[model samples]
Target: MTAPLRPLVRIEGDTLVVPGLVSAHSHAFQRALRGTTQRAAQTGTFWSWRDAMYRLADTLTPETIADISRRAFEELRASGVTAVGEFHYVHHQADGTPYADRTALADAVIGAALDAGLRITLLRTAYARAGAGRGPEGTQRRFSDGSVDDVLRDLDTLRTRWKHHPRVRIGVAPHSVRAVPASWITALHADAKAHAMPLHMHVAEVQGEVDACLAEHQRRPVELLAELGVLDARFVAVHATVLASHEARMLGEARAFVCVCPTTERDLGDGLPDLTALRDAGARLCTGVDSHVLSDPIEEARALEMHERLRLRRRVTFTPDRGRTPAEQLLVDASVHGALACGWDVVNGDRETSWRPSTRINLRARSLADVSRDDALDGLFYSGSAACVSGVDDAAE
Candidate 1:
């Protein structure tokens, strides 16, 4: 006799089957900065904290980067993040020289993520300058490829090497408006489009960056990016906290994704984003644990909602779009949209591929014990923590 079919939605023990969380932006090596840079007197501002980060960057070698990145990816896995868009920028040997392999540091980072059992989208970043007219100095030396052609060459090599990798994908980043000029942005965007790769950039993360972009480009960061033809559905604007209403509309019209790192933004004293403006303007939202200040995806989602409530002085600041509830909306931001930001395709099926990593939650945890199926997501986003994620499974792509 044939056996009866099992229910697809059955409660398997105490686990909650949900889509895996995605970290849309990350600097895995910066995980080391957690306890070291939190001191009050030293980290007076983001610029001050960056000095400490540069010092740490100067100390990394392939071996050390591998070790630290492995631990960081492991933490992300334990916190229910099955996929990450690692904004890897540290390149070259100390003293501004390229390694023999050219992509050695990037290879180490990808190896670590694979070792930690997480899907990785290595956002190969280009750093051509320290600022508009200034050359790279100190730790910044390690990040530069000297010119846009060099950056494209490295990306081509990386893509060819990982062309068959199931859990590893490649994208391009221009670092930031300060780190690259208009010509570089235009060229990189063209390259990304030619390859059909996702593109990301740090846009208006702080007031100083905005002022710099305005002074150097005669326009704000987003405005300059739009003018340069860099805004699009595949573009992700990281930490867009200082955007103007018109800028929000521009991003929305392009259907670009805005990846907000709430915890890290708060830690660095970056102002909160205008969520209402962005939503009304038609932009999609995603979350990231940038800087690894907090590795929990649930906490990141909660912080996004809390920050909105605080800013608007009202409850339920973010409403559901396309028939989802507020809690569901937040979860989608943490998972589905995040995958999209990282260039992952979310499909509905049991089949697993590097482009389709999945994550499940623990329904048996004390925090979720009394939650009904309908209310489970609400409990997780509103009152739960990463500690409630008891198990994480990764499928080889």
Candidate 2:
């Protein structure tokens, strides 16, 4: 019997074709907070920094949201990100009122992603209370959808609107254990499972969150979710920065994904994640540009390896037993694993179609000029920057 034909391969000009980077987590509106929130006195801690973000969140209207999202998504595409998982929570109008359409803000964000020529997974977030046992106050009003039924209704509308659009999809995000009760998470998880959607949430990003969860539930954040039966392959825990060893093992055993946003973690003083522990527990890793602190996927990938090196005081600490180099592994985290976390079928679907949103790197860029074809991936991650991203396919939109 004849072997099946492989897709014809081609190399054109000085370009290298690779899987496009998937931004597994992003808060696109926070892109506007970059220069303005850098004052030392205002952002000494994560809570303080959050205050600054809240201020910005209050000022966004549907128009401003679309503009900000378009600009941020454009920047992401230019930096080699072909798909984005937008963890959007700013849902209601100011003063905690729903817009006439209910999904007005969500529509703006999705339109922006389409206009900017990128695939989008809008992880419409459910932000109920301000925190555990606290009421929605001040700017928190904008993020709350009132009830789980309200959130599910809005999600149904969004799903119907984008059901036929290939470049757009929907997912569920219970903001965090801090923002919602355990009941809300279980309900959202059930809805997510029924619809076969991806479920993401912030988990153990900082010590304060862990402390709050422990005080309220007698368990760490991941432990609570695990007990609720929310730990599974379709679940993605964004910013699993402060996980205990056993929690890491639980996530790995459940085959869940942990998305680390390194630059934002550094900016917010969130401690580096226990990379070795998570890997040893068999957890797959992915990266994101959470707060738009930076939009470079290559830098995010490099930072993951560099942070591990700094923690362990050794070079190339993330090398896997499968014999792939650390650079290769990091790239996979940025691209393939990221796509998986965004609910893209990267493993079993047609490469060209499933990975509709793809990016191309310029081998002729100044940073990569001296590198040979054999060392292209290494050179791109180590020495190259987003400036090395030449063109992204328009098919993603």
Candidate 3:
């Protein structure tokens, strides 16, 4: 006789369980500056806020960086983020000399993730310089390398050395258009293709950056990348807030992913992007904690939802009842594309067996179920925060 079908939850003494969380884009080093940077007197546009960032960036030693990253990774894991993409750029010494091992800083971060029991992708950044023929100015020196070739070679070496490791993966990022040249973008794209690695860049984050790219390249940042043939599915354009209609459409057509850091954007006062419009245009959207100013995925997800609400002046942005809720969409963005963006494997159904027990999510909580899976996921996106995350499961290990 066939046995009775068992319910999904196990009653082991009477405790509830849940799944793991994932973080798409994180500048681990920025965790250190959270409280200290807020007191600065200047008006806090992305550019003005960056001055504070530069100060924090200047003080990090590999040891300190590793410590902060480990702590940040732990906090993320506690919040249910099982994997993280560390968008790292602080490479080399203050004097701009390579570490003896060259991959020293990246190694520290990877080690921190391992210690924290979280999966990690090191998106090592290639920052050539601030502008044309201008070497890195002030605190930016630590983040720059001499040539794009050197940067690629360093990444190649790091990958070769760490490719066999289980939890650590490597990807490439060209700091931003303003920091690197068009020729470098082309070459970096080729390198990304050759290595079969993911490519991420900060695009259209600030007016100054957009203006500078337009002045020098005669095209907006997104348009310039498109013209250079660098815009594609493999690319993750962080903060594509300053896009025009055409650029937004182009992102959708290219099958590119846009990572929106709503909390950080709001914190820094950078403008918000039209997420629903972008989704309708066929662009895949994801969320990022970005600056770690508020390392809560729930809040970040909410920001995405609220932006839509404010843009349209309506309530209930993500509803799974009428359709998928904003929360559900944002969760998928944080979990599914988040994993893909960071090169982590997405665990589905039986595939989840390969992942850590804590990484397996169970959406049986009232907040999750209050809106049916069929209801719009807007509530989670529009209203949820980190306080709502009870805890992840440590089941079936």
Scored by TM-score, the top model is 2
Q: Candidate 2 regions off by >4 Å?
A: 1-12, 347-354, 394-397
What TM-score does model 3 achieve against the real structure? 0.86
Instruction: Estimate, for each residue in 1-397, the C-alpha lDDT of model 2 and write its tens digit.
Output: 5434322112467997767788999999999998876777978899999999998998999999999999999999989899999999998888999999999999999999989888899999998887777889999999997689999999899999999998888999999999999999999999999988999999999999999999999999999999999999889999999988999999999988899999999999999999889988978889999999889999998988889899999887765645566766887788878888887766333221134445788999999999988788889999998999998774533
Weakest lDDT window of 10 consecutive positions for candidate 2: 2-11
lDDT of 3: 0.74
* Each candidate: RMSD: 4.1, 2.6, 4.9
Candidate 2 local Cα displacement, residue 281, angstroms: 1.2
Q: Estimate each model's TM-score.
A: 0.94, 0.95, 0.86
Tens digit of per-residue lDDT, candidate 3, span 183-298 = 88899889888877788999898788889887888899989999999888778999888888888888889878898888888888888787766776667777887788888876
Cand. 2 TM to true fold = 0.95
Q: After superposition, how far is residue 115 of candidate 3 from its true place, in Å?
A: 1.0
Clashing pairs in 1: 20-359
Better of 1 and 2 by TM-score: 2
What Cα-based lDDT does every candidate model obtain?
Answer: 0.87, 0.87, 0.74
